[model samples]
Target chain A: MKNKGDIFVISAPSGTGKTTLVRLLLSRFPTLSFSISYTTRLPRPGEVNGQHYFFVSEKEFKKSIAKGEMLEWAKVYGHYYGTPLTFVQEKIAAGKDIVLDIDIQGAQAVKKKMPEAILIFLIPPSWNELQRRIISRSSDSPEEIKKRLEAAKKEILAAREFDYIVINDVLEDALKELVSIIQATKARANKRWPEIKRLLQA
Target chain B: MKNKGDIFVISAPSGTGKTTLVRLLLSRFPTLSFSISYTTRLPRPGEVNGQHYFFVSEKEFKKSIAKGEMLEWAKVYGHYYGTPLTFVQEKIAAGKDIVLDIDIQGAQAVKKKMPEAILIFLIPPSWNELQRRIISRSSDSPEEIKKRLEAAKKEILAAREFDYIVINDVLEDALKELVSIIQATKARANKRWPEIKRLLQA
Candidate 1:
């Protein structure tokens, strides 16, 4: 059998540049497919329907959830969001590496279901830098920023559970580290055993 | 305290060109220190003492082993060879990465003492290629070549116990994979945790 593609679950606090790092990885590794999450929330400006997320009706999202289509789904701010297992399975069967940008809860859920999934945690260089990044976004009020900083603290503490943690000090360095992790994971003994076996027989 | 250097134990069969790959790696990464083994066997012509091996007397080698200085030692063809643990510890304390070229038995011995050591197995692309390479050496008689091939088979079987198996198909590709593995290993959570902790506090 051909080697199965790896499922990479990346998690980070909101201001840690997780999305940017994943985007850079996708650009560099064309074989990787970015998982499109399903969300019940309204689409924001400049967000494409399928590219950003699969914006679904709350009823439809719940229906799919009830049908057990979602690999992992969670509610946030009174809206539901999830990753579709079927899409991920299909991509993996086609030998495409899948990158999932999710929160810690979602990452844990994915891991529970697929023990082979690689969990990566992205974090800001420092708490001060994280605060600076959150403030620079200018999308949140002072109170909201305070709440996010508190959440970031809890998230950073949870990083010990991750397989790899990429510190986003410099964007270039973080990207390189992320890329290396992905490359090395694919070359792991468990994943490449079939090829090794064939070589032995040859 | 500074980050302790990583001990990388690289093992391969007779014909995989593992030495060439390691030489290329050392040239590329100056931070890595090639571990010089202590050998009781007399040095071959052109082999430098301290550079190639310590070239100690059998009595001195036994004394060191009795004193618990050897990290991993083996007797092959009635000649005793070993790695000096004290020298390795000194270099590690000084934060210099050490690369050990050893056999599976030596690797296992080192791992028993230092569980954190990374073991890498380098393999040929195919058995046919391995046979071809071994034959090309032309130093051994036909019967000797047959015995060497038998040993190679056993060594390849032992690769499953290693942390990583690098397939030496193309020289450049294998080098890149080796580099990526080392880079990713240093970025692993356990090794990078202190820096991450400092970053969080900062």
Candidate 2:
């Protein structure tokens, strides 16, 4: 019974309700934990240490990057954010399934290091809804939002590389699909064949 | 919103509860349909014409093989058993999820033809339990039991090629896993990406 914590790498374009879905998953699946990212960006209002991010200085962040401690990192909105490999590995060792709330680049980096990780791309049901949501939830200006949407084209293309693509049409349906994927991934032959063989021997 | 029938190819050694699990799946998910296999074998005591198998003459079976109408076919216990391609294709076209109860060889054949099919292999929790179930059921004599056990060895070895290997340790657990697998397979990125992209374009 090898019950190792498996990482779920979630990638989504802006305005796909990725954050809300992540929170919903946290509430729905008790076994899941979030992988807090390390960033050089200053915390926004109401953001707390270790809750939102592990804020670090430019020099410290760069040092971590140089040491290859980051599973995936990128400079966005003139700030750096990345998943720390050490923290994720530690949580997995503690038998907690961790969600990597990352962009495509970060997801790819994690996949390269851990081939067993499940990569899921969250998709907005329609472009009109996506644009509407992005505008409505503007933590960014119109100009900034345009830039993010432009970047999204490139990000959405990466969905083709993911192991699963979840349509964020309805929150409940998407969440149900996500949990089912976790359960089903665990039942994969590569994961369970050994146990079955051992049972035969016993 | 395209609802393509997701396909699950399930294989198991004899007496591993595959039949029971599949029965539960059919009743549990109204959207699913089990592929009816065409066979040349004379029906066993209680088997029906289209339920246990779609009985056909040896000539008809060979003709189907020549016409490439069988998805997969093999000789078993001196008779031919095969899945009819048209039956599976029709159900899928009609948007009914399809489950093919097959051996590993049949699963491999189907997978080669349909690259997207999800393969699930079922196993008993232990050899002792499997043996007990088979012997206690008293379906065969001691000599026949030995042969079936030997065949089980060869069949279980082939489980490695499957996508998921579920242990029927408890029927409830195995059935839950099977249901989860069918749901999750539809979420595979390769299967969903194009549709997601199209929805976004709309």
Candidate 3:
């Protein structure tokens, strides 16, 4: 019998370079799978439907939520976004580790639903670095930047709830830490029980 | 404030290549420290007094035990062995991660006293491999080999008490897993709280 795979719920405030890290992580670990969220928000430039997100109508997104098909859902900035329960369950049952990139609230909801899910928070090295990243990556007005910074602080406080934290000081170092967390989780006793049992019996 | 370090307690059955893996792990992670146990047994070939173990008389070992200086101790093969409590506490409080190579009972004892200590178990990939390694590495008689195999089986069963398991299938792969476990533990939320808090305040 195969051991069930792990569910890694990774959350980070905007401008923490989480997206880039996740992209690199997925590429490095071929067996790792990403869970794409279903969103009612319009796709941004270069974002593909079903690849980046399953772009859905507001009614369709609401329908999934009402039908209990969504594992975790939240309305952020007036856009509905959620993870589908079946996809995550199927992948994990098939012994494929899945990465879920979501906001803090979504991560909390997922953790509540699936207590085994490993929660990871990504943060910038410092507040100044966080602000620099936000400003450099966006064309937001000073007021907008201020608002995002405030939100980031609140999210950073919630980081205490996470099981692991990756400091995005340097891309390479952050990626290496992230990879170590994934590889280490795979070595957990519960995850390797089947193979271990087989060896003992043999 | 400096971030408090971790105590990684690694346990394995005989012939699992644990000693080789641990030697390589310590070489790679210079910041990591090893906790040498005090033993009543005489030093084997190539074993240094303080480096390999603190060779002590049985009376001295029992005195330490009476004084509550031993962190964890066990009698095996008519020899007394134990960790020095003050050394582990001082190194950890000074922000140095320490690795403890101990038996299953000692690992369980350390965990009881220090709940935060991460316990890792190393095992051979297969029972046949475990037997082969034991036979090849020693000049033990067939009866001694049989006794060791029985002991190994019991130790393997105790692996469930561990937090992580590294299968010693390929030396390189096992070393990589061992390193990943150490790196990942350093990234744990509790371990990085000081740095994370400083960033938030800044």
- Candidate 1 global CA lDDT score: 0.90
The predicted structure with the larger lDDT, 1 or 3, is 3
Query: What are the per-residue Cα lDDT tens digits for candidate 3 across A49-144?
Result: 999999999999998999999999998889999999999999999989999999999999999999999999999998999999999988989999
Model 3: docking quality category: high
Give the per-residue lDDT of model 1 (tens digit) for B28-120.
999999999999899899999999899999999999999999999999989998999988899888988899999889998898999998888
TM-score of candidate 2 against the unseen true structure:
0.92
| Candidate closer to the true structure by DockQ (higher is better), 2 or 3 | 3
* lDDT values, one for every candidate: 0.90, 0.87, 0.93
Give the distance in Å from residue A127's predicted Cα in candidate 1 to where it truly belongs. Answer: 1.9
- What tens-digit string does per-residue lDDT give for candidate 2 at A48-167? 989989999989999999999988899997999988989888988876789989988889988998998999999888777878888888889889989877777678888999999998
* DockQ values per model: 0.73, 0.78, 0.83
Q: Is the docking of candidate 1 incorrect, acceptable, medium or high quality?
A: medium
